[model samples]
Target: MNREPLVSVIVAVYNQERFIGRCLRSLLHQTLSSEKYEIIVIDDASTDRTSYALELFHDAIRPVANARNLGLAASVNRGIDVARGSYIVRVDSDDYVNANFLHMLSIFLEMNGYVDAVACDYLLVDDGENVIERVDCSERPIACGIMFRKEQLIDIGLYDESFRCHEDRDLRIRFDKKYRVYRLELPLYRYRRHDSNITNNAEAMRQHEANLIRKHGLDLAASNGMS
Candidate 1:
């Protein structure tokens, strides 16, 4: 019998009532084995209709609610703690995936068995769920559609909660230190871009990213393999 769920998809939500439903819908409709993957929705003390929307799929999806409103970093780590899958995925509640999102991701991870994480290309969607632009991130990996190995994360100390927004960047540096990663050449997600996106808060996000680099004592020479 197969003992491992291929992917554990975690979507951390705050007050994203408007987009969470669409995001969940995309995940539920993925052309992947429903039994071989699990979808985790973490409602970070959202004071919006996000919870009611989540209940619509509570029978199918796993929902975790926090006691108080923790930030995104803390919330996603919560999902990681309970994830039962061998491989993991971190998606935002405001983003949606393609129909074969998990299916394609599973294929790539299985293809590159030695890699600790897989990052795929994505499309930028608008509030109306219409594609505004296609973002090909195969050249540069970000967290939006990143697929990771569960054990790798546990060994490297999951996402750093200190930096509120650039947690993904921090994890990338750490993961790259000990393991290889694959940049899959598939566009398998619809990364919704809106005014409320965490990256949209340029100042705060940049500060967090800089701090993460400095806090970890990371240098360009090391990450780039330069002498």
Candidate 2:
């Protein structure tokens, strides 16, 4: 018999053949014990060798292949549906994290009874792994580097599948309203910025941002931070 995993790390991928291997490798190398965490990789109907790359880690990761491309939010939701852990963390396939990422975040959550979630500082890197800038996440933190209590997120309805964009901000809005998300100053995550990033679709993102504002019924002033 095996012990239940303490954390479920969800990695959502979409045609990330070039980076998925490195991402999975980084995860496999986490300082956290293998038995302590479960890696759930949701492949969003990749057309490239992303699936093949993931297959290489068959023993380490539980792969979920989408029949069709359901996009990021839906893919994440799918992973959450099957996740079996006390805590949940989201990491994009194109991005990778430091070895101590899980140990730091998980221990913090376990110790801080008041904090519902925790996020960490991240380095914004290009495809070449060159540092673009360091996002201390001084203001609004990103959804990827944060770890949330599984029950808390499930109670809040997980990721909004309807939101193809601004899903993180939408969840944060509702999450912050009920629970607190603490920021760890340590740079434990490496956020990769590339042309394929969905944020590059300005028009689509703007439309989604509008939809998000409408959904929450916020004024223009408050809408600026929608993403």
Candidate 3:
């Protein structure tokens, strides 16, 4: 009988042909045993060669392709829906991670059952993968490199489909209300910064920021003791 994997690594991709290969390769090279974790890649209707890039790893990953473009939040939610692991982690298709990324994070969670979720520090890199800065996940969190207990995520409700941007922030706000996300303090993830990054779109980010603020305004104010 096949035992279920301990961790499920979700990667959502859209028009990331140029970097998806490297991202998938990094995941395949993890120190964690292959049977211990499963990689789920959701291709969000990429019009580029991203499909071909994903095809190279056809046997190694569980691939899901959307018929139409559903954006990041929806794609991630879909991946979660199909995941069969006890724990979940998201890794953007354009970014990569160190060989120990999964082994370290999963081991921490395995030993610390009380923790609902755990995040690790990451190295920010340019398009060329040069180290720019080592970011503190607790102080400045990004969407990925965080591993959450699957049940905790489901109990809190998954990513909001309404959010085209700042989806991570929206989910984090809701998740933090009930459970705490502990930090690992190790730079195991690599975040790639490039012009095509969604955050670079000031207008979209501004709009989503407003939506997020409105959705959680009361909670935010109370946390800040303004209420």
The top-ranked prediction according to TM-score is 3
Off by more than 4 A, model 2: 219-227
- Using lDDT as the measure, the top candidate is 3
Is 2 or 3 the stronger prediction by TM-score? 3
Q: Residue 109 lDDT in model 2?
A: 93
Is 1 or 2 the stronger prediction by lDDT? 2
Residue 149 displacement in candidate 1 (angstroms) = 1.0
Model 2 lDDT per residue over 1-227, tens place: 99889999999998889999889898889888889999999999999898888889999999998999998999999998999989999998899999999999999999988889999999989999888888876464676989999999988888898989888888887887788888899988999988988889999988988888888867642633722
Reference-based TM-score of each model: 0.90, 0.95, 0.96
Q: 1-227, model 1: which lDDT tens digit per residue?
A: 76667789999999988888888888888889889899999999999898898998899889999989888888999999999998899888888888888888788888877667777888777887788776667554557688888999999999888868777767777777898767777778777767887778879966875686586766742353210
Candidate 1: regions farther than 4 A off? 1-4, 221-227
Candidate 3: worst 10 consecutive residues by lDDT? Answer: 218-227
Tell me the lDDT of candidate 1.
Answer: 0.81
User: Where does candidate 1 have its weakest 10-residue lDDT segment?
Assistant: 218-227
lDDT tens readout by residue for model 3, 98-201:
99999999999999988889999999999999999999888888899999999999998999999998888888888888999999989999999999999899
The per-model lDDT (C-alpha) reads: 0.81, 0.88, 0.92
- How many clashing pairs does model 1 include? 0
Q: Looking at candidate 3, what is the lDDT of residue 138?
A: 82
